[model samples]
Target chain A: MHTLHVELGERSYPIYIGRDLLNDPQLLGAHLTGSQVVVVTNETVSPLYLDRLLAILGERALVTEVILPDGEQFKNLETLNQIFDRMMHDRHNRSTTMIALGGGVVGDITGFAAACYQRGVNFIQVPTTLLSQVDSSVGGKTAVNHPLGKNMIGAFYQPQAVLIDINTLHTLSPREFAAGLAEVVKYGLICDLPFYRWLQEQTPRLLAREEAALAEAIERSCSSKAAVVAADEREGALRAILNLGHTFGHAIETAQGYGKWLHGEAVAVGMLMAMELSARRGWIEPAEVVAFRDLLRVINLPVAPPADMTPGQYLDLMGRDKKVIDGRLRLVLLRGMGEACIVDDATEEELVSLLETFR
Target chain B: MHTLHVELGERSYPIYIGRDLLNDPQLLGAHLTGSQVVVVTNETVSPLYLDRLLAILGERALVTEVILPDGEQFKNLETLNQIFDRMMHDRHNRSTTMIALGGGVVGDITGFAAACYQRGVNFIQVPTTLLSQVDSSVGGKTAVNHPLGKNMIGAFYQPQAVLIDINTLHTLSPREFAAGLAEVVKYGLICDLPFYRWLQEQTPRLLAREEAALAEAIERSCSSKAAVVAADEREGALRAILNLGHTFGHAIETAQGYGKWLHGEAVAVGMLMAMELSARRGWIEPAEVVAFRDLLRVINLPVAPPADMTPGQYLDLMGRDKKVIDGRLRLVLLRGMGEACIVDDATEEELVSLLETFR
Candidate 1:
């Protein structure tokens, strides 16, 4: 088992990565000191692992489960309110620990629910999906989508602990598994070149669910996210880099209607667009874009833009992105494969021209 | 102006208290930093003081205003969403500072709106009503009511600065002014005895809207709240005392439906109930309960329980309060007149007896 602590002072917590760690009471119990435990999961993930999680929790916690509708379309205020409503209905206080047991959608909504419940409460991330285990579970970025923009209404609430069991990945569908790898690949493109190279070498072993390789991938991804978040807990500066492909990705998701495209899938295609724009602006070579796209394709992730998504439609949605500063679109373009920069001064003509190339 | 700073490190800001600080841009500009400002007000307070606030903000800030429907009934997630929708529709960002310009209701909803937008931006409080100018505007207690309990869903987001202009209360109706005083009297019962006596002597002056007496009252109330909050930021311990009349008060408001009773009025009656219970428990004498009730009555606040509420109904409603710990009723009772203690083991019998007597 590998333990990586996200050093956020009082809000700091550990990310436990290994086989069969989800059922480990020592790790899960460390974060759950409350009398009542509410495990919030989606329909898909609950039937598979809810009982196992309950077994680990034992009879001590007055545990109750709230199974939400699975998918990104349900990741809005309405769903977020249901979690709040349930917690209030149960009369859960600040001490109640909410365990989020699903993918990024569940983790994000659950964490946001915990953030707003009684102003804030302790929540543990028992991330079941690859997308969550590798990415959303580590960082304290919790939010629900607003009608105007994806993740428009949210809060930066750190979790007490994140429990990731590599065995759970066996339950993931091939497409969902590939989507999670998109964010894993993102950490490399935005920050670590060697890790990207490592991911390149370990792709086959990770795809085959080799425990050691998967654990390494999860640990590396968490470390990268943890360091960025710890330095800038509120994403005031350094943490914004984590949203390298997210601005474009959110626009794509909103354009497609949230659940139509998986968050990681949208990000995969968005990352390609970002890299292409970087190459067009002479920030990186054309060959680099090809390599980035090739790596995504190798993982069976979406590399090309959605055929029906017009640049005008993408541009309109991107304008509503939270990343937009002072009414200007701020895109995090890659200075190189392992480096990214926030470009807030990019003119509409420049963005429109770059966006038009998708045609 | 007397300034009180909520020492929350980076999240900290100042609270400026005086008679005519509304037109003083020095304090407002210290926080606004940029040229663009968005003033959030209500229909009632807008026509009264929007021109003055805008004039102080000046042409430098491309001043935008969002005038919401006026009332406590509007204080909910629906109204909160409107602020986020408008902020996004208008493309406001981290740089934009939201000025909450009205009574407690507007300040609370605006403060909560600011807390949610872009995962929280900056906001200043230009409290118009006496309740907000003295109470809600100073403490970082920002929230909207849920159906089950008041402030059941909210966050403790501190503001950039709280600007209290006593002159704004000149237009406040008598009922509204009395509601504000209920909170002012709360400080006396829970923490400061001398301040409670000072309030007793100064009640007539404050009721008559005398500038000196009102300013002193506002300053004292804020100072006491700030001291307690500084000791406990999230109401984890000592901060719970701040909810002196609030536990019972929230039940009253929730039972009557939130908009029917002003928060301060409910709290006024709630404090009376708390004292009667305390007296029954041998915590305080019967005369002390009358003293507490008389002080609230002197402020033109309600001392009796609501007409239709039953003991069982109040218990059922208060059981939903955030203060209830481990499924036990935790009531903050006065040790004497000025000091308070949180008793978690309070029986249903004691609460029932008090309610029966009130009936």
Candidate 2:
């Protein structure tokens, strides 16, 4: 078992990574400070893990389960209200602890629900997907999708702890597993060169679901993210770098309609676009962009945006992105491998020309 | 102008109380650090002061107006979504400042909207009613009501600054003005006995809307609230005292349906109930409770729960209050005049007897 602490002063919490950690009642029970507990999971995940989590939390004075419909499309205010309705109906108070047990959608919505329920309460994250275990669960960025944009409404609320059981990866479909790799690759592209090289060499082992390699990747990804979040709890400046492919990815997610494409899949294509644009601006070498594209291809992730999506559509959707400031679109572009920079100077013409090349 | 600073370290903000503070562009503009501004006001206040506010913010790069319908009935997630829709429609970024220009409902919904929009942005409180000036606008308690309970969904998000213009109170209906004074009197009952006495002597001037008396009441009320909030920002311990009458008050509002009973009016009655309960428990004098009820009656505030509400209904509704901990109802009861304490040991039988007496 490996534990990494996100050093956020009073808000600091640990990320526990290992196999069968979910079976350990003590590990899960330590974070449950209140007598009552609300386990928020989606339908798909509930069938697999809800009973196990409940059995572990069996001795609690009260335990309520809210099983939401699974998918990103359900990650909106309407669905968020469902959790609120159930919790309020059951009379969950300020002292109740909420445990989010599912993928990113479940984690994001539940974390947000915890953030707003009675003006914030304690919540824990038991991320069951690789994408969530590596990205959403560690960063404290909890949100729901809006028709206007992805993650348009949310809060930067941290969790009491994040429990990552590598065994859950065995249940992931091949496509979902590949999608999670996109974020694992992102950690390399954004800030860690040695890890990028290590990921390149260990790609086969990672894809094969090797426990040692998976644990290493999860630990490194969480460490990099935790450091960035500790430095900039709110995305004021340094933290914006974490949204390297998110602005473009949110555009793809919003334009394609949420749940149509997996978030990691859209982010994969978005990261390639960011790299391509960086190459055009001479910030990164074109060959390196090509190499990254090949890696994504080998990993079975999308290397380009949706075929029917136009440069104009991208511009329109991206304009409403949270990254846009004062009518200017802020794109997180790669300055070089293992480096990312927020650039608001990218003109519409440059973006259009870059999108045209995809045709 | 008298300014009271709510010392919250980095989140500290000043409450500017005086006549015509809204007319001062520099005061309003000083806190707006963004190029774009969104002024959220209700229809009742829009026609009265929105144009004046827009004139003051005319020089901004972009100014958008979102005018919602009036009343607390509109203070819900559906109405909150309207602000998000307008902000997103206008492409307001994280840097855009949201100015809430109305009474408590508008300030709360707008503040919660600001807290959630793109995971929060800067917002200013331009409270147009006496209720907001002394209470809602000063503290960072921002929320919208849920059907099951009032303020069930919300955040503890502070504003950039609070601008209280006493002149707006002159336009308030007599009942509304009285509702606002209920909170002013609350400050006396929970914390300051001297302020309570002063309110008793100056009730006539306060009722007449004399500027000096109103200003003094507003200043003293805000000072009391600010001191409480500074000690406990998230209502962890010290701040629960500030909700002395709120748990019962919320029950009254929820029972009567929002907007039917003004928050302050319900709180006025709730305060008396708490006082009566305290007296019954030998915590306060029965004579003092009558004295408090007399003061409320003279001020035109409701001094009793809705005649239709039963003791059982109060128990059921109060069970869902945010103050409930581990299935225990934590009521903020008075130990004596000018002193408040949270008590969870009050028996259901004792409560029923207390409610039966109201009959």
Candidate 3:
């Protein structure tokens, strides 16, 4: 078992990663401070893990279960209200602790629910997918999607703890597992060169679902995220680097309609676009773009934007992204293999020309 | 103008109280950091003050006005979505500042909107009603009512500055003016005996809308609230005392329907019930209760719960208030004229008897 602590002063908490940690009652009990608990999971995850969690909680605390329908499209204010309605209906008070037991959608919405439930309450994350375990569950960025944009309505609320059980990854579909790898590669591309090289060398082991390789990957990703969050909790400066492909990724997600394309898949294509733009600006060699593209291809991730999406549509959708400040779009472009920088000097003409290259 | 600072560390802000302070551009501009602004107001207030505010803003910044329907009944998540829809439709970015230009409903929904819009944005409160000026606009508590409860969904998001224009009180109806006085008297009853005595002496001046009396009353009320908030920002311990009559007050608001009873009016009757229970517990002399009741009667505030409400209804509704912890109801009762304490030991049987007496 490996544990990483996110240092946020009073809001600080730990990330527990290992095999079958969900079955460990002692680990879960240490953080369940209240006499009542509300476990928010989705239909997909509930059928698999709800009873196991209930068994661990066991007669000690009054428990309420809310099972939402699964998918990114369900991550909206309407679904968020369902959690609120169920908790309020069952008389969950301010002292109740909420446990999010699914992937990114479940984690984001539940964490946000905890933040707004009676002003605020304690919440723990039990991520059941690779994308969530590596990125979404670590930082306190909790939000739901809006029709106009992705993650347009949300809060930066930290969780009490994050429990990651590697065994859960065994249940993930191959496509979903590869999608999560998009984010895992992101950490190395943004800040950690050695980790990137390590990922390149251990691709076979990682692909085989070897326990040691997966645990190390999860630990390294969370460590990188925790350090960045501690330094800039609200994304004032350094933290914005973490959203290297997210601005473009969000544009794809919003334009394509949420749930149609998995978040990791959009981000996978978005990262390639960022690298291509970075090459055009002479910030990085074009060879690096090909190298990253080759790695993504081998990992079974998408390397190009959808054929139907045009430059005009990309420009229009990207304009409304959260990264736009004072009418200027800020893009997180790669300066090198292990470096990312926020650039706002990219003009619309340049963006159009860049998008035209994909055609 | 009288300026009071709410000491909340980095989140601290100033509360400016005086007659017609809303017209002061320098005060408003000093806090507005961005060149884009969104002014959220209601139909009732837009025709009255929105144009005047726009004149002060001039053509320096791009402004988007969102006019919502008036009344507490509209203070729900559905109405909150209207603000989000308008902001997104207009392409308002994170750099835009939100200005709430109406009463408590506008301030609250706007504040919560600011708190959630792209994680958060800057917001200023221009409170046009006495009720908002004295209470909701000062505290960071921002929320919308749910179907089951009042203020069931919200956040503790502070504003950049609170602009209180006492002159707006001149346009308030007699009933609305009296509702505002309920909160003013609350400050005196919970922590300021001298202020209570002064209010008693200046009743006629206050009722007559004398500018001096109104300014002094607002200053005192904000000072008391700011002090309590600074001591405990999240209602941990010291701040909970500030909800002196809110537990019972929220119950009445939820049971009777939101717009049916103004918040302060419900709180006025709730305070009397609290005093009755306080006297029954031997915490204060019964004469003090009568004295306070007589004062409320003369001031034109409601002195009893709604005649149609039953004891069973009170228990059922109050049990769901935000003040409840682990299924135990916590009520803030007066220990004396100027001292308030949180008590959780009050029996349900005693509460039933207390409600019967009111009937």
Write down the TM-score of every candidate. Answer: 0.97, 0.99, 0.99
Q: Report the interface RMSD that candidate 3 achieves against the true structure, in angstroms.
A: 0.8
Listed in order, the DockQ scores are 0.68, 0.89, 0.86
For model 2, residues A239-263, the per-residue Cα lDDT tens digits are 8888878877888888888999999
Question: Which stretches in model 3 have alpha-carbon errors above 4 Å?
Answer: none
| Fraction of native Cα-Cα interface contacts (under 8 Å, chains A and B) also present in model 3 | 0.81
Q: Write the per-residue lDDT of candidate 1 for residues B154-254, one digit (tens) a residue.
A: 88898878888788889999999999998888898888889988887888988999988888888888888888888888888898898888888888888
Candidate of highest lDDT: 2
Residue A162 CA error for candidate 1 (Å)?
Answer: 0.1
lDDT of 1 by residue, A19-56 (tens): 98866877787777878899999889988999889888
lDDT sort, best first:
2, 3, 1
lDDT of 2 by residue, B300-345 (tens): 8887788999999999999998888888899988898889999999
Please give the distance, in angstroms, between residue B61's alpha carbon in candidate 1 and its true position after superposition: 6.6
DockQ of candidate 2 relative to the true structure: 0.89
Cα misplacement distance, residue A328 of candidate 1 (Å) = 3.6
Residue B303 CA error for candidate 1 (Å)?
1.8
